[model samples]
Target: MSGAVQAKGGSRHGDPNRLGHGEVPASERGPASKRIVVSYGFWIFLLSDFVMFSGFFAAYAVLVGNTAGGPSGRELFDLPLVAAETAFLLLSSFSCGMAGIAAAARNAFWFQVAMAVTALLGAAFLALELYEFVHLIGEGAGPDRSAFLSAFFALVGCHGLHVVLGLLWLTTMMAQVWAKGFREDILRRITCSALFWHALDIIWVALFTIVYLLGSGAGA
Candidate 1:
């Protein structure tokens, strides 16, 4: 009697809507899971990036005042221009956020518009940075001039390189979205880009506060 009842219960439990322990339900095996996994993996990558930046920051801090009779940050830094660069980057981060929102809503037009604005702002920031570098080099404050100059170039140039890569990534994402219509893979890439841009914004804030504001004697 007990054996017969157990067999009947097992048969009733084998509904198509249910799955065994080792089996993956359709909902659990789809794009939702993929998105979660991609986000997790990308976050790990971002953390590693943060670690690298932290090391750069430590080195810069140690070498910031080693001017060796060369121009110091107080003499070389144009606070107003740096403020403008910060404004542009912050605004670009905002536009990037809007782009991500538009992507999530599947509004291609707004997404494109927001991304274009972001790219433009990012370009403006990079242009200003390049101008600063040119002016410094022309003033004979090249990286080879002193330990301070070398550290400054290393720290800030690394950040600038990241911005350049970010701009390229932004354009590629735009093209991918245009071509693929925000498919899960493309959307994941967009999400990762957005995260990266925001992370850069945060890093810039720290850089500006430490290297610009304090070094300029403003925060100091």
Candidate 2:
């Protein structure tokens, strides 16, 4: 009631700077545009994802040394394979960037090509990670073998699941682009997906360092 009265009184008083008096209309400075809203919302989603990963990382840190008379990371991990996975994911990030560039320039052929490259690289990374997991489980170092392995699988498997989702998103994006051309909403989605793909790269780098490099060092 008071807010409405204030607006009414302000209008009656001819206040030059008041909102209802309309030096500048409220509509002119109203809600953010769709692109701004979508981008902002997607970043909030990414931050929440990071927070979830942080919890996983902390749990892994606490349990990293709790191997129950089982093989440690150094004994179980294959660094060469992990290194290859890292290479593939990093290259996917680069290719994703190229796809974004092509999208911005509205180059259909290059965008499709770059997106395909990104998808292939991302799939290759996932393949290597899956093989590593299967090999470890075959070697009797499965998650149930020890607390350390449990934490490792939880953190790394969560990341792998996200990669799978990202690949599905990329496939949808390519389909959307092909069907719709460079529509504004589609471009916004492409930008958000690129950001997401790059974020996975960053997380993998940290995972590689903490779970592989430092974890192995601890075994020494």
Candidate 3:
């Protein structure tokens, strides 16, 4: 009878939620460790990227009015073109989120479709930005034209470069999904991609508001 009571007490003490001496909860053990580590590391990377962007934002804010007698943002910025670029990027982020959902559900067809749409939207955004840059340079308002132009190019071009990199990353993820299916590793990569794409949309929104809208005298 005493042994039976002791066994019952031990069982209760070993409850999955109960962490005794040197015991780990099931929620924090095994495969969960890998997922937690990967996500935490990725978040650190994103935070570092944000810090870099902060420096660019500060530089642009300081130099925006130093146009050296060249055409100002009010004269050069095309609101309609910028609005289109913003739309494409924002929509791509939505589709990328859908792709992540499809990946989690292991729906290969929907995942591929959503990813394809996202890639196309991202490409369209890059194309529009390239056109804007070409038009500016053709008008002799290139980065070398003035301090304001230099800061504008540095900020916007940095973002454009990131978009190009994101497109490449998206293409790689598609290839990985096609080859590996919705395995754990593939899903993790998809999650990271979703986070990255959404972060870019947020940054672009800030850029649009501060650099484009305000610079164009919309808020002035």
Report the lDDT tens digits of candidate 1 across residue range 1-220: 9999997777667654554533566668657567788899999999999999999999988888788988889989999999999999999999999999999999999999999999999999999999999999999999999998998999999999999999999999999989889898898899899999999999999999999999999324
**CA displacement after TM-score superposition, residue 17 of candidate 2 (Å):** 20
The TM-score obtained by model 1 is 0.85
Tens-digit per-residue lDDT, 20-135, candidate 2: 63555667787989999998999999999999999999999999989998888888777888999999999999999999999999999999999999999999999999998999
Please write out the lDDT profile of model 3 over residues 139-158, one tens digit for every residue: 99999999989999999999
Candidate 2 — which pairs collide?
A: none
Query: Between which residue pairs do clashes occur in model 3?
Result: none
* Candidate 3 Cα lDDT to native: 0.91
Q: How well does candidate 1 score on lDDT at residue 117? A: 99
Candidate lDDT values, in order: 0.92, 0.92, 0.91
Quick one: ranking by TM-score, best first?
Answer: 3, 2, 1
Runs of candidate 2 exceeding 4 Å displacement: 1-28
